[model samples]
Target: MRGYQEDTPPSSISGDEIAGMDDEEAVFLGYLDEMDELVDDNMEEVTDQEEEDTDMEPPEDLSILVFNKHVGSVFCCDLHPSGKLAVTGGEDDKAFVWSVQTGQIVFECTGHKDSVIFVGFSFDGAYLATADMSGLIKVWKCNLDENQQEPWPIAFEYEAEDLTFGLWHFGARVLICGAVSGDIYVFKIPSGDIKVLQGHNTRVECAKMFKDGVRLVAGYDDGAVKVWDLKTNAVLQQIQANVHDMRVTAIDTHPENNIMASISSDGKVILATSSNGKVVGQLQAENDLETVAFAQDPQLGFFALGTLNGDVGIWDTARQMVRHQCTKSDDESVVGVTKMIWEKDHLITGCLDGAIRVYQGRSGEKVLQLTGHRSEVLDLCFNENENVILTTSDDGTARIYKYEINKDKD
Candidate 1:
């Protein structure tokens, strides 16, 4: 070791003691210290992957919530941002609410004249919105507090037809919605005001604000991926030319929004950005895709891709490759994937076959299969209460599933 001076012996390396005994040893030791720091920062990650390696099994203890039926197929669902309740939309042309904890039906919202395609919560869990094929979006004032018996009345509404999808900006009170007419509308929550954004040459399949509200991304049937500035509401970039060989079904941003990915009906998954507006990498699952989710933890940078053909591919986004994939039995093609949510080591899956399965994110395996819905389970949400899961299905119902996490699983 090189000696440091207590007072005045601090001359820089010059003579034999400074240079003599161990030049190579000093350089090697410095390199070792640098490596040690890197290891310390990354040790938890290495441990997580190792845990994935040993146990890919879903947890065993899964129980059903309440199941209240709708008249027709339930098309979509959104959990109250509080996770204490759920709102579901369906072919029945109605919306219903359920208690997440007790598995009980609470309210059935009636207003939309046609089938409801999508529903979502405001950032604070105070408001909710649902969209239908008629191009109308209804905003409702909701109270998730279990103390209330009757549901709250409709607070406000926005009208749109040929509607595709709508999502609130990350944790903001504003919403960005898109329609088949190639118009993207941004709605100010609870106020019922709207802005129509125009650019795409065809129907917009999905619209969501990314990078907090700094940027907005929309995918259209023309295979075009467009980015917009949230403030000026201007098009920032556009990348087109057949993203999949078919329709672009869904798109979502990485947690940071610096990168985003889109899925095409022809089985294409693209990783791209707004700056250069090019796909960094791409993957084709077995069949057309439904939804894609990025992991919450940044360093893990994992993603789960759900396909219409019953195939789910888990990706290490940093490595840009499928780390593991699983197909349910041999007969089930993944018709849908709700979202990839992490609970400790598990990534819970909600499938179109009305089955909710959990898998170890590190290795793709069926950990638990929650069977209850008589039809396709279209939407699911996790978090809030970490041990519980919420799902809505085509059987015109919403159900919650609960479980206990054991130390062995962790």
Candidate 2:
């Protein structure tokens, strides 16, 4: 596992912090807690997630349909904006779709020969895209109402060695992707045209589109965060990458602020202003974080980070401290977490033990403990429209659960 980099006090910049947008560092000082390992490395990974054998059957506690046919480890799952269709990618070299209500495997799209590390649907839900470890990215258009074999039509396909995937840094639409050669490729959709932004000292880890996709913010393994102009494809701003000499695992943008949050393989969680390239706040974690998510509503004012230590920390980004800590008694580190939007009061988390636990965002109460995957739970998405949860497990399955949600009455 990589280690967290120690930080000096944040850069003192003026006229950048958005007013009434979020709390300042002084306010965050009160929220600091000792458990949040304040070490040198912010993104240190606790442990790497090992692929569970796909041959195992899902545990009965879960309520969704098992994907049932993939031969490799599933890495991620995402639901369409419509909430009826779902998609998953895994180590098995396949990406599958399922009915959110029926638990039936409606589509199993396969072609990539390597592990499918990430998968996503477009903002409008018109397209589905998947990225593999080998840097292969494929786009599929959905037409599930038609024949199953034709559930998705092949749209765009590219390889790392050939065109170099700039797989839409934020979504299938964003114009930034990481090159295997350690460069940032900023390109828009459909045209497949690209502008290669060279300068990262190491491999680019993640990139994001900002405000209507006109600007981009990105982080790399070398520890630098660069803000770029989409129109000109120029480096507008840059933050040095030495504070933490580790891999950047996850990064998220504050919907309303120019602020960006990044977690490293070294275990340091940091916030930087994309507009000016400055750090707003920082938190140290005990283990390397696998995933991190910001709340849809900043007033609920939260973000969740899953650690390799089998723990989940619910942080109040405003307060600058973890308000809640969730840990499995066993050594089951959490791999994925999502903040439920419609139900802003809750969060959904997936762990290596294949357990999908739903918890209250405030009280940290365990709301539901669901089981379905035979192996580890890789990804989770919530469909508030139907009150069901979509999850993909390492057992080669994606399942939907619709358990009742009854509020506790006195």
Candidate number with greatest TM-score = 1
**TM-score versus the correct structure, for each prediction:** 0.76, 0.73
Give residue 71's lDDT in candidate 1 (0 to 100).
Answer: 78
lDDT of each: 0.73, 0.66
lDDT of 1 by residue, 151-253 (tens): 6778777676677777777667887777778888888877767777885568988865675667888888878888888778788877656655677788877
Off by over 4 Å in 2: 1-59, 103-105, 147-151, 162-176, 199-201, 327-343, 403-410
Model 2 worst lDDT window (10 residues):
40-49
Error of 2 at 178 (Å): 2.6
